[model samples]
Target chain A: MLIAKVIGTTISTIKDPTLTGRKLLILRQADIDGVPFGKPYVAVDTLDAGVGDLVLTAHGSSGRQTEITKNRPVDAVIMAVIDHLEISNRVTYRKE
Target chain B: MLIAKVIGTTISTIKDPTLTGRKLLILRQADIDGVPFGKPYVAVDTLDAGVGDLVLTAHGSSGRQTEITKNRPVDAVIMAVIDHLEISNRVTYRKE
Candidate 1:
């Protein structure tokens, strides 16, 4: 999963049946250091992420692992809000 | 699919079996306007694309379309080079 920030939401009154009732958000992807990366892309929100929250994103078929996105038109999805991350015995981030 | 420019190559002494003999190139993705986007990422070359060539990329399962990448551990791969692009009522690019 990649780190991203929730920037906005898209209104989709009608969408793929599997996506019904799931929230979708426009997330700006970020690097491991929390630096923004690339153009904004839409991601199905699974972790109740809100604007300004840092989120973990999953892509490819794995993004559809959730029942709400399974076999759906979804590509990217938020899976978790990282409270902390450690790499090689280094503390990278801790939720403030 | 996204547009990208081949910049360099990575030499892998060994890789997934299906990737044998296929040339892989490191491609830098670009926006619709040919502007650079995000950090550099690698992509397998399929169309004999060389450095500085603006190419078309396919992601997800589709990126594994070729026999070289089929059933292999591959994600981003370049499928074609964009000689031109047209969107709306305007001509966007033409091979120089």
Candidate 2:
């Protein structure tokens, strides 16, 4: 799973039927220090994560394992919201 | 999905139970012209793709959507073997 920050939401009225009712959020992949990088991509929101929330994103088929996304054609999903992150024995980020 | 090339295989004796019997291959992410970049990662092979084969890889949750990967903890999966790729009316690659 990649650490990312929820930057914005995507509004798509015309899409696959299975994608209906799914909340799409724009995610900017972040480095270990929580710095955002690369181009942002849209992902399905499963944990009610809001913008600015740090999240763990599951991409591809793993994105569809959630109950709401099962058998769907979704490619990316926010699987968990990060309360804190530690790397190399040091705290990098903490929610709140 | 991202385009990649199969470079090698991975052997894991200890892993998630759901990953048993899964074939793991090392994939090098490739650019539009099939030039590899960044570090390589392991992905579950669902399409029987061989080494050097150009494939389309699905990541995260989307990786588990295949029949063999359902409910697995795998983060990447080769979902398709590319027969050809074209961009801007130019043929970039064609399987031989």
Q: Which candidate number maximizes DockQ?
A: 2
Best by lDDT: 2
lDDT of 1 by residue, B1-96 (tens): 456667888888788776777788887766544555667888777667788877655568656655456667777676555555443334455556
Point to the candidate with the largest TM-score: 2
- Model 1 chain B: lowest-lDDT 10 consecutive positions: B84-93
TM-score of predicted model 1?
0.49
Q: What is the lDDT of residue B33 in candidate 1?
A: 48
- The per-prediction tally of clashing pairs is 0, 14
The lowest-lDDT stretch of 10 consecutive residues in candidate 2 chain A is A83-92
TM-score of chain A of each: 0.81, 0.94
lDDT of 1 at A29: 78
lDDT of 2 by residue, B1-96 (tens): 999987765443433445567777666789877777865555789989988888999876677788997786457889999988899999998888
